[model samples]
Target: MKKSLAMLLAGAMVVASLTACGSGKKETTAETTSDTTAESAESKTVSDGETYKIGVLQLTEHAALDAANEGFVAALDDSGISYEIDQQNAQNDQSACQTIAEKLVNDGDDLILAIATPAAQAVAGVTTEIPIVGTAITDFADSGLVESNDAPGENVTGSSDLTPIKAQISLLQKVLPEAKKVGVLYCSAESNSEIQLQMTKEACTAAGLDVEEFSVASSNEIQSVVESAVGKVDCLYTFTDNTIAAGMNTVTMVANENNLPVICGEQGMVEAGGLCTYSIDYYELGYIAGEMAVKILKGEAEPATMPIEYYPEEKCEFVGNEETAKLLGIDISGLE
Candidate 1:
């Protein structure tokens, strides 16, 4: 009986040892898995915490372009991504744009935001490796900045500030029913202006109104151009051309003095003393560009495949300058 009891005790000891060994093995594996999971999470956190360097090249300082820059920065601020920005303005100088573009590229920026067509072109000319986002541009495809609006097929994409030219012409007809001759004025050097001019010509022809075009190479000739158009055309039509937009005061002063109501391309021009416009919100356009930049930075999207974005037509506003209307002795009450 004693021998049997001892044997039973030994058997119980062996079972306990086996049970302890199994429990230890399971505990070790669980601990190892927990440690590995923690390390992986930490690595991911470090990668996400990296700060991005962004460069912004703006064409010139104006109400529309300034608003675009503000909106772009606002988007980046809202994105929760840590970033450093190098903001540079070309002051409407193409050469300055080229210099700034080169500087930004040399600085090794991760991404670039080009405000206008010239700025975008400058940056694109500098680097094909760096991603570029353009805003306040009329048509990316027309400007040769992209292969197509639907598929950029390159490392360039953003929002287009292409306002409704047809609607604008209709507005012009509504405002000035008796006016027969319309003078189209824009900067000849601006590709965006050229596109708008073509659309304006088509729209004017369809409306059965005689249209005349006046092109300026630079802002230096704005005064002379406006004076030349005074007696020939009943109303002057200006586009969102950066050159003309910058010198809008001179253009409007001349037109207002001659009692020729100017139909502007944007609210900034209207506010600067033009008559009216169907204007797109440039700030919203920039915000859209900013969102695209965020997607590119996060690897969520690529500029090569991203289609150019546009503000919805419903978002456009029919804006008129009341003071200018009063000066021109024209009634814009119907616009309200």
Candidate 2:
């Protein structure tokens, strides 16, 4: 009886040993599974953190817009974010801008940067879900991109190249103090031009300078319209209208022939043929847009809450084309 009991006890000990071994194997398997899950989660996080893609739509090859593009790219590079850029120029055509924006949106670009007023309008028409940033836009209100200038109030918000009309008027007074009548020249189709022209007229009224708006529907009309204006107003004011900018040589020729000093809306125009300008750096404005884009992509800010920003300060330059200056015979030494 004692021997039988000892054997049974040994048998129970063997069973217990087997059970302990099985539990150890199960624990090893659970640990392996946990490690696998941890590895999978890490890999997923890495894949999710890949590079970003940005699409840029510029209205034309104008110097100001080109500078904005440069600034944007530079800022992106500075952020150390891997990004792919697709840039297209609309050649100052609204329909072309619309088509390019639609293509970019359809291609699943992560963000869109529209460089001018028309370009911004085109992107706004394409998609509201995708973030649209605008730079070099003259007036957001004039383009109907937003409800108010103080707040963009939409998916679209960015920098404005809208030089203060009062400042422009002040510059005009500095250059042509004795002039009573001023002619504002721009393209009729450009909302930016129209808005700037209206502002000019209002500022002129306040400054006691009679202002007449001269609109050209295309480059073909600029020469004739500017000539007519040259005969009418004592001085000329040119806006950053792409059409007018494209035909700057013609306008300059007409103004120079009539001895009328032309004050420009931006520095590029002044650099091309006008007298002087108080304008913001288009490149700086574009960099500001790039900064906003980084914030959006990182989920740090919402476009609706971020009001469009302006250049911290306007940059003024006395870009007097010596030839144009000589022809107009306007001594701007005081402005210099």
After superposition on all C-alphas, the RMSD of every candidate to the true structure, in Å, is 11.9, 11.8
- Write model 2 residue lDDT over 68-115, tens digit each, in one string: 988987787787666666777777777788778887788787889888
Predictions in order: lDDT: 0.86, 0.77
Each model's TM-score?
A: 0.85, 0.81
lDDT of 1 by residue, 1-336 (tens): 999999999999999999998886421111111321111111011124657778888888788998898898888878887676777887888988888888889978889999999999999998999999999999999998999999999889999998888888888999999989999999999999989998999999999989998889998999999999988998998878899999999999888999988998888999999999899998888889989999999999999999999988777898999999988888898675
Give the residue spans of candidate 2 off by over 4 A: 1-49, 314-318
Instruction: List candidate 1 stretches off by more than 4 Å.
Output: 1-48
